[model samples]
Target: MERFAALYEALDATTSTLEKVRAMEAYFRSAPPEDAAWGLYFLTGRKLRRLVGGGALRTWAAALTGLPAWLVEESHTSVGDVAETVALLLDTAGIGGTAEATTSLTTWARDRLPRLGQLDETERQALMVSWWRELPTRQVFLLNKLVTGSLRVGVSATLVARALAGVAGLPVAVVTHRLMGDWTPSETLLPTLIAPGETAAEVARPYPFYLASPIDGDPAQGVIGALDAFVAEWKWDGIRAQIVRRRGETFVWSRGEELMTDRFPELLVAATALPDGTVLDGEILAWQGDRPMPFAVLQTRIGRKKVSARELTAAPISFLAYDLLERDGVDWRERPLHERQAELARLVEAVPSPRIARSEPAVAGLRVDEHGVDRVRVELPLPPVAALAADAVGRLAPLE
Candidate 1:
């Protein structure tokens, strides 16, 4: 795909480090590798560009400059630290805000990697680390994560899959299902999949199938009331995650593609506690009793290499599922939201089983009829606050 080669050209173009990061992000999203080796390249490039533009990579630079590599590794290998490292790197560089920095890095990385695709994992890691050494130790760690492909910014797989499908001129549904198996697909597939009319970013739908672009101001302020198309979910202020129980094994991945079940033992236990052979859409929330704990409380539970027993006990996480993506070899994404919700509910409560969420009825319809069968669709309503069944207000919270 020209996208891979295009990104490589962008990295070497060196308009700015922000451009490098942006290019790198696109590369990682599509490159298709995530092991420690790949992680090295991704993280290394990430930190260098981030540090250069001024972010968390700076603190690492400040503390670890010319310091031994061992100490730096300890601080930055973990996911949580890696993210803060980005912000810190920018800060160190005297860079401000993500917009300017990310854009600069995106373009720079585009110019940095000339033969990026041709390099093997070890060579890629070495090249990234050496290049990062030009920065500082903290930045090194950040770059380590990047070179290794561990720059996790909560980008969703479905988003990349959509992008890939768009490039391929195939239905997004088909692309998404192709990735529904044990292995995650690479970001490089995107340009390969790009249909002639679409852009790479267009491939990813924040909320796919059913679409809702962000709006300005509070959505409750008459925004919902004006929409002829749209639906609203509380947008649960928690980690966006997917629960896939396939081949009798359950995997819980944050939207960024990090397999995070171990960090919240309760979640893994809770998820495995449900039915087998299914995929679910939900938020992993910090809970005490039935109500959700504040987003602050949940924050401690995310992005960890290991969760202590103490942490697990104090901040328990729960999967508040909303829809089912798969069941028994079926791809349910094309199914209406209502039916998907029902199937998701079935995963938790069919016959006798544990339930992660209750089925809340949502309107589903045919967006376009084809081949004599009606396609199920998600209906987004006008907003202010989301209402149910068109006119109901107080009892409803989404579908406005």
Candidate 2:
């Protein structure tokens, strides 16, 4: 726990990317694999759901520190953070004690945190107070934040992946693929996660999504003179999702790295129509007949563990596949956009389902005059009416 706290402080104190990566790499090399796994879990921005409410935590801290409840509340407000406020108050109250007995991060997380849920409020409070007395100030702040599920550091998942890759002597992409999907921190899984090769077990993982930069200036200046090098599609106002079909199983992941397989059963059923080892990058939108419903309609299904039959019929979701990331266990991200777009069109056409369809393509509008100067124009189709507006939307790129 103390080592993890020091790593957190080192990461927080620096803005240099190289320094952060070095600190993370050093910690990964020295810490036990079990302890490092928990550290990786937290450092990657994954947090346990709030097991205890903020009010209860504040009250408990106030009682332990012998401070008035109102004073604690005021300190929290002044600090703009509840965890830091409680730590500061406790530290100033002179509740120091020797760190004679030590606990590992793995033991505290795997064995201790879960037991708190089974205990009564009195028992929980006593255990928390004991922890406060024994742990250092840094660990105390971290513990408070962890209990409320509000811990946040400046480090990003990308940096963490890079550090792990450095420590394991593997490519960053391999490390990234291993980190995807659901897996618990254990002695067995840790070795497999850092290994150089893929695990034999069936796992559905998503490829890293390629993102486009926002247009800042004139749209024409953003594109090269070539008129047949790019493909354009509607920027749908829906959840950006990746549908993965691998090893005779289908998985759906949102842009936020959430595995939403059970949330949309209809999509999973539709995925069975696709071939095994096919991966798609697309948008999930609510549709009725040939038209798309508002994003608000899809919001009702988000975060749901199970969707009722009536709700399924009412919303009626479909996937608007835009690009093909993988086909038959082979990655196609290095291929040109036009080639991928053609393959995507073919795949969508073969599916033949109302629940899955291809996104509308942007056709190039061009003309040639007597002067022999080639002129190019692009057309974008609007929603609901689906009419082409020649002068409204700016061109992203010319289609091949």
Q: Return the TM-score for each candidate structure.
A: 0.45, 0.82
Which candidate's lDDT is highest? 2
lDDT of 1 by residue, 1-400 (tens): 2233345445546766545555555564554432212332233223322322223343434443453444445545653555455434434555332221221233334445444446765555455444544543333443444433444433345454554454455776565544432232233433333434434332221222232234345544454443334333444567777777665566777765556756766656656655555777777777677567778888887757699888877787667776676667455655655556555666666423232565243333323244332123543431122222233221222442
User: How many residue pairs clash in all the candidates, one count each?
Assistant: 93, 0
Model 2 TM: 0.82
**Model 1, TM vs. native:** 0.45
